[model samples]
Target: MQIFEAIIGHVEKRCEAKGKRLTTQRKLVLRALIDANQALSAYELVDYCKQYFGETIQAMSVYRILEFLEEVHLVHKLNMSNKYIVCSHIVEGHEQGIPQFLICSKCNKISEKIVAPETITGLQSHARQEGFTVVSPQLEINCVCDKCGQ
Candidate 1:
């Protein structure tokens, strides 16, 4: 609980630095994502708010909040899963990196990894060779986590 509060404080400070306000609704949505510790759709976040926080937030509002959060680097959207997760770097007090998500196919657990810049460059080079443009270097890999694999 203390750690969660500290993370919230950090987020607040970050927002203030950017001259953006972390409104109550945004905080609620962030809290829900942090508490869940997993990727969640916008509607799932709405349900989570209602179920756990006893606050009613519409899906549209949640989506807007998510967009804001993503813009500020406080959250990330897993495009492959069409879900969102709080940026692990923010929670862990680390600098942001090019993220790669290992999504467990069996248990739905997601592990976030910060990969080397060269890896992204290599991918971009490969895409260029294929006459393709690489947009959004984020990678989502599907695999079974250790626990689930066992």
Candidate 2:
């Protein structure tokens, strides 16, 4: 939570090293995601970008940047709701580890937890025992919050 700035800095450095232009729009979008504790959809991101950045920021451009961010592990795409969230870790590549999403369907609050290597191994072993190959850990658990229950 307190280390988003460090992650953004590292990402910027990586982009620089790769000779990729760290465009203003890209920075803004990533920053918005970093600032938002909850996952945001592209539409939400586009709206925020347009509001804070003015009308010059096109939705298509936002989508493109979001896709690139997702590709590079700077962000993770939530399959349950088709939203995007900044990765819990600033990993170099996207598909290195199994990402477990703790999502609340009622309030739409999302928390990401990275599966340890051993946990993954155990999961794989269990899957193998069941004659099934585990692919992804995109978990979306539905529940009612305390406030909502009251």
Candidate 3:
């Protein structure tokens, strides 16, 4: 299996700094997400772990890990697809702009993009004008990727 030692190390440090423990199963789960080209559901991650590591992981366990990772910003949950993908900015630590996802409906591939501050400000401004509270700044756009489009 491909290894992401650097990313794992960064996550380990981040988890420790946040007073959270990154368990072995959690690390493997993150690695599975990192290795995947598309978003994967918790069940899919269990299958991947069994296939690659010859280890059986329960879907519940994976779900818990995904929750923890999402809480720490090490992963992002795609609500539309019910799948999870690793955060692309993990290696860079904290990022400047909010992260937006371009999800390919055909292939389930997710590409990460940073929404410009101005655009986010505009969105917030519009929401304020409408008297709606901004819960989260993240955005997900549905589209076909180049590979799937062609």
Q: Kindly report which residue stretches of model 3 are placed more than 4 angstroms away from their true locations once superposed.
A: 1-3
Ranking 2 against 3 by lDDT, winner: 3
- Looking at model 2, the pairs that clash are none
TM-score of each: 0.95, 0.72, 0.86
lDDT of each: 0.91, 0.75, 0.86
Backbone clashes for every candidate come to 0, 0, 0
lDDT (Cα, tens digit) per residue for candidate 3, span 1-150: 425987788779988988999999999898888877568999999999999888888999999999999988888888777889888888776743688998878877778988999999999999999999788888999999999989
TM-score of candidate 3 against the unseen true structure: 0.86
Query: How far out, in Å, is residue 29 in model 1?
Result: 0.3
Model 3 clash pairs? none
Q: After aligning candidate 3 to the native by TM-score, how far in Å is the CA of 127 from where it should be?
A: 2.7
Tell me the tens digit of each residue's lDDT in model 1 across 20-130. Answer: 999999999999999999899999999999999999999999999999999888899999888999888885545677999999999899888898999999999999999
Higher-scoring candidate on TM-score, 2 or 3? 3
lDDT preference between candidates 1 and 3, better one: 1
lDDT of 2 by residue, 54-129 (tens): 6456778888998888766688888767788888776453454778876765787766777788887887899899
Q: Work out candidate 3's RMSD over C-alphas.
A: 2.0
Q: Ten-residue segment with the worst summed lDDT in candidate 3?
A: 88-97
